[model samples]
Target: MKTWILPALGTLVCWGFWAFIPKLTTRYISPMSAMVYESMGAMVIGAIVLAVLHFRPDVSGKGIFLALATGMLGMAGGLCFLFAVRSGKVSVVAMFTSLSPLITIALGYLLLNETITLKEGLGILTAFIAIYLFSAS
Candidate 1:
C-alpha cells in the first residue's frame, strides 16, 4: 500500500466527520456560536501539537505569513460552511461544498502551471454538471 493512500483515506474519514458534526452543532445554536466552540476544540488540538513539538518549529517569514493567511481564509470559509449547513440539507450542502477541489485545480493550473490531462478535463466537466444539478430547486 502507498503511504499517501493511508493518510488520504484518513483525511476522507476525518473530513466526513467534520462535515457531519457541524450539522449537529448548528441544530442547537447559532452558527457563529457553534464556530466559537469549534475554535476551542481546534485550540485544544493545536495546543497538543505545540507541546509535542516543544513549542517550536522551523520558521520562515513568508511561510509564517502564508500560514496565517491560510488560517484566516479557512476560518472565514468554515463560518460560511456553518451558515450553509444551518440553512440547507447537510447532504446537499456537503456535496456542493465538496466542489472546493475544483477551485484548487483551477488555481493550481493557473498559478502553479499544473497540468490537467484529458481525463481530468472530463472530470471537471462532470463536476460542472453536478454543480448544475445540485443548484436546481
Candidate 2:
C-alpha cells in the first residue's frame, strides 16, 4: 500500500492539472498547437531532469517511437477534449470524460492481464454511477 500511495497521489495531481490544461490552452492557441507546445514542453522538462540527475535518457529506436506515439495520442486526446469543452457544456464534457478511467481499467484487463478485485470492481461501478449522475443534463 505504501508503494502505491505516492504514485497514486502523483498521478492524481498530474491528472488534476492536465484536465484543466485544455481549457486554459483554448484561450490562447489552437488546440493542435497547444498540444504540440505541451508535448514539447514535457520533452524539454524531462530532458532537463534527466541531465540534472546525470541519467542518460533512453534514445533507443523502440523507446523513441513509443514516446512519440504516446505524445501524438495525448495531443489528439487533448484536442478532442478542447473541442468537447468548447462546443458543449463544460460540466457535461467533464463528467463524460471522467469515465475515461473505465476505459483504462478495461484496457488493463484486456492487454495487461490485470485482475479487478471485488473492491476495485465496486469502485469502478461507483465511478460509473457518479459519471452518469454528473453527465445527466
In terms of TM-score, the best-performing candidate is 1
The 10 consecutive residues of candidate 1 with the worst lDDT sum are: 128-137
lDDT scores of the candidates, listed in order: 0.91, 0.80
Instruction: Residues 17-43, candidate 1: write the lDDT tens digits.
Output: 989998898889999998898889988
Q: What is the C-alpha lDDT profile of model 2 across 1-137, one tens digit per residue?
A: 68999999998888777776677667787776776788788889788998897897657999899988987787778779887866676667777887887898999999999999999999998988887787775
Q: Tell me, what's the RMSD of every candidate?
A: 1.2, 2.6
The numbered model that scores best in lDDT is: 1
Question: Which regions of candidate 2 are displaced past 4 Å?
Answer: 53-55, 59-64
Looking at candidate 1, what is the lDDT of residue 50? 92
List TM-score per model, in order.
Answer: 0.94, 0.76
Whole-model alpha-carbon lDDT for candidate 2: 0.80
